[model samples]
Target: MSQGKLSPRQKMINLMYLIFIAMLALNMSKEVLSAFGLLEKKITNANVATSERNVAFMESLSTMALEQPEQYAAVKRKADQVSEISATLDAYLGDIKRQMMTTLKAEDFEDFEVQDQPDFLDQR
Candidate 1:
């Protein structure tokens, strides 16, 4: 009740306020992590679909080349070059992804967000 001193109730209220702030921080961290997980899963799915489409595109090119070598020979050569370059780039990206996983000490990014490893929120 005095200006210089906090009463017991005031002290308890302050402690509760701090605890509430901490809990809010923890909840916000979880929400951020869940958002990141959702984004990662979307990117992963897009990469997979793109890779599959690339393979199918090359396969179709090869078939066309075989069916009409005179008309599609150049297409086949370009397809081979594209495939080689894609493989090289994919390997490089895979290496980077591996390093990221190792840094996080995570075996795999789960499809769903996990509340664990809240420290990952600090990586930024």
Candidate 2:
């Protein structure tokens, strides 16, 4: 429709339609951004909760090892390694989330409607 010159009224209608489409796109983008922000927040919260539970489990394992080395030393060592790896991974993921939020200048997921962390797809 925009390939060549056209009548003034047709051009006006095309411009108006383009503007309407742009408005719709803007609204959709905001909705999509809100959804992504909500998802990110949920994942982050889940990670924190899981990490906390893992830490507690590791502590209990350490206590068991202290109480009975013959049985739990190996188990505790394995648990320690698992905890280390999980902690490292959680830290890395948390850092990425923080960086994304910072880059987008978005508010914490505490408020979803205002979040702008919609650029999470960029691997950079």
Candidate 3:
């Protein structure tokens, strides 16, 4: 709008505008990060519940196999194999998570309240 130069008041107004916009952006990012943290917590809880249910089901299957070996033994064996594979994959993923936390120097994996920074994984 101004062709030549801006007045002192105009400069202050422009500076305040920039600061206001930056504050809004910062607030929005925090809110989004908080939402993500909540979602992560919910997913973790669900996983734990599902794991517990799976264990109970496996136990039931084992009992059934004991009662009727010819009918349920094969099914139980297959379930055990699947369980073993799942354990292996879980351990592998856990190791990867530990490595990431070590690299990031993070004390707690669930802590997401820290300020946003550039992607450290990208630096690697």
Candidate 2 scores a C-alpha RMSD against the true structure in Å of: 8.1
lDDT of 1 by residue, 1-124 (tens): 3589898999999999999999987665556777888887899899999989988988898899999999999989987988899899989988876655554534445633453554533574
Which 10 successive residues of model 3 have the least lDDT summed? 113-122
Candidate number that wins on lDDT, 2 or 3: 3
TM-score of each: 0.57, 0.57, 0.63
TM-score, candidate 2, is 0.57
Tens-place lDDT digits, model 2, residues 1-124: 3568798998899899999999987675566767876787798799789878877988888898999999999998888787788779978987986776675443444565566445665557
For model 3, residues 1-124, the per-residue Cα lDDT tens digits are: 6668988998999999999999987665666877888997899899999999999999999999999999999999999999999999989987865666664445645666552443545566
Q: Quote the lDDT for 46 in model 3.
A: 97
Clashing pairs in 2: none
Give the distance in Å from residue 38's predicted Cα in candidate 3 to where it truly belongs.
1.5
Q: What is the lDDT of residue 60 in candidate 1?
A: 90
